[model samples]
Target: MANNQGRSVRQPTLLEVIIVLGLFLAIAFSFVSVVDLPIQLALFIALFLIVILGIRLGYTYNDLQEAIKSGISNGLEAVLILVAVGALIGSWIAGGIVPTIISFGLEIIHPSIFLLATLIICSLTSLATGTSWGTAGTAGIAMVAIGEGLGIPLPMVVGAVMSGAYFGDKLSPLSDSTVLTASMAKVNIIDHIKSMLYVSVPAFLISGAAFTIVGFTATGHVDMAGVESTINSLNSTFNIGWIMLIPAVVVIVLLAMRKPPVPTIAFGALLGVVWAGLFQGMDWIAALNTTYDGFVIETGEAFMDELLNQGGITSMLGSIVVILLGLGFGGLLNHIGALQVIVDSFKRFITNTGRLSISTVATGIMANIFGCAMYVSLILTPKIMEKNYDEMKVDRRVLSRNTEVGGTLTSGMVPWSDNGIFMVALFGVPTLQYLPYMWLSFAAIILVIIYGYTNKFIWYVDDEEEGQGHELDIASDQKA
Candidate 1:
């Protein structure tokens, strides 16, 4: 048999394309809301429809299978990281590490400025950790509890946390999305991050200002009693102290030293297990179980039980399944030439720099919606748009930055995406409820498009000359 990669096929008609998407969405909505199905199942049902479409398009089952494998490969790394994060969460909570942070955060974070502080703190934590999932699951959960106790709205708080987490994730050299974007565009991670700041920073500033205003103007009265009770419950539940923070600090230090994410995060989890045994007086078997099954606090208070009783590799299973199914759906669509047809159709309207950039952003957002994860979007967007970038003589850094803006920053905005599901599970807020509040995440995309048209910080390659700048770009891309 011959290889099927790059084999030309009939492009899908616009009506056919809309029909598939519409069917998927209709099924998704039904399963997600009407039947009360888990997101994984809903995505699986949608995936089956796409596979059926591929069959109708004359693709063999083998070709579809191969495409599915190839697509899942793009997100395999993220799956592993998410699993490790689950283990980290369980271990950290059981070992009192997360409890210690929550305890301290509650003590120092003033109610009047909590939203602003949440933004900064989450940004710093995500910057150090390089994982928004990790930041959201750990500090984000704690912030939810704190915000509720402060009588602030959950949606607003989630927005602030998400904005910060994504901001750091987009810019952090250690982030998988950041690295993946730079790699796809053939640019240095550092250079890619530097270019991103032109859009990311301003969006963040505006978001911060909004949070600040909300903090001051929020009508909710502070439940001081609830705050004290929650803090006291945390203090009684774990061996809360400064020493418990050592594991998180160690992970941050290792990240600063350019350590890889998997081992750094795994080690942090192990440190938590050790702390559980040493400081929390937890049995070795119990601590080990925590890594597998997450922390279990039988606090009488529902909020505390919900806040503290999450984590473990087991908890991450649903998300892993959703990612695989979502990627598989996209993979099958790509295999059937459905997605490629959409990309090609856009080329006709992309007649200039601004249109090209806008199209790239549009494709990225579409990838996020259809691909259902940032990793998949990042991979697909560049594959569909990089040639256009090269043809336009635009620097790959711009493409890299735009992908982060359109894809990475918008992943959590999608209702059923892996990142969105994770946020919903972590913070207990629906994606739509928090969507409007993620001003920074949405703003980054807008700012980039605005900059794209204004010609601000947009770089281009020289076609006729082999200058030092070109050599430097080549060198940077090589290092990345």
Candidate 2:
């Protein structure tokens, strides 16, 4: 390609791509893991390096700037959702919704079954909200506190939380990631979800079983006194009641009705403000203040104080910064053709269905690692592999399913990625600490690779006329 100045522009060579990406990984890992600094700075430095690479590839500064803008635009929905979730969490706490849920949870959930229950509850919430972030910030937080009281390890609790959350995120039709993946692969959203069920359901069952086994065999003694005291603090601090749950209900109902997530969550936050005034005895000013700065209370109980002292728009600022930096870095890499070069390097190894499947999965994983965002991976991976799948006569849904299995599932494990930063910020658990416990993600990836080799659930274009056709017919019937 030639630039506007009539200068020839070329893709980065494999060696140059390797060097730039290797340097980026070294810098990011060194700064984030060893130096214990924030990931934003590392990403910024990486972005700067990519800009130099882009210029070296003969792209003008203007062309590179457009790529950065485009990358950031791709993730604007997530940024909006994060902002809304922050306000929603704060308002819900101020309105006593989360406290009520936690109070009820503590009373009913047994220590022997807490881990399994956490997974189930988070799955249901994420399925309903179509948002792992919202589920994590809300029910996941409550579960963490409950786990603390139950004497279960925090990492175990967060692991269960994330597994369940991502389960819904991967399969839910309402999820943005799900929709994006399906669109990019030219598959129907329903078809995309149905194809993923083969991998996701087994993974979910395995995760549930694992949590159950761990929950039952655990020797840690539950702190009944702590649980009771925490419950009491919740009751005294706010007007906890079933009615306070209305805000959450509204959000779920709106989402179920297929309302847009941003406005739905914002509306829920508004209702929370009203509830806080009516039931929590807070004036409108104080309740509204909580929406921006989060709810503040003096419960005199350290655990209660710590759990409740969160939320607010300001709280999401750090995450937003990380997301922006990550997206910018991804944009620069894409513009410089570094990502394309990396993907092309994997093309020669795709000699069979199994090789193709694993190669696609590996590409998705690498995209998330190098792109610093799941959106970047989801967008780029399918586009890169779409032609390969078509030429191989494979069903497009397989492409979408494998893309999500590789991209969405492992995104939270990359400590510098947007999902990873959000998980860490919300749960205060290091990514590495809870990573091993993400049973569903690990299971899904393994299952896809296994299925690819075994030819199980690997749909082909010819099979679609008889197999996927019937499935689509059934789906249409069910919709009717």
lDDT of each: 0.80, 0.84
Residue 449 miss distance in model 1 (angstroms): 2.1
lDDT string, candidate 2, 70-114, tens digits: 888877877887888888878888888888888888899988899
Tens digits of per-residue lDDT, candidate 1, 1-480, equal 223655444556877888989888887777766897777777878777777776666666777788888878866776777777888889988888887877787788888799999999889888877878767865676677678766788999999999999988888888877998888888888888988888888998999998998898883477778878888988888888888888987877776566777777788889989999999999999998888899997889898897788889888887788878887877777667676778888788877777877888888888888878777788888888988987887888888888888788888988777788777756668887889999997778778777778876677776334331232355545465
- Location of the lowest summed lDDT over 10 successive residues in candidate 1: 463-472
Over 4 Å off, model 2: 464-480
What are the models' TM-scores?
Answer: 0.89, 0.93
What candidate 1 gets wrong by more than 4 Å, as runs, is 1-9, 462-480
lDDT of candidate 1 vs native?
0.80
| CA-RMSD of model 1 | 3.5
Lowest-lDDT window of 10 residues in candidate 2?
469-478
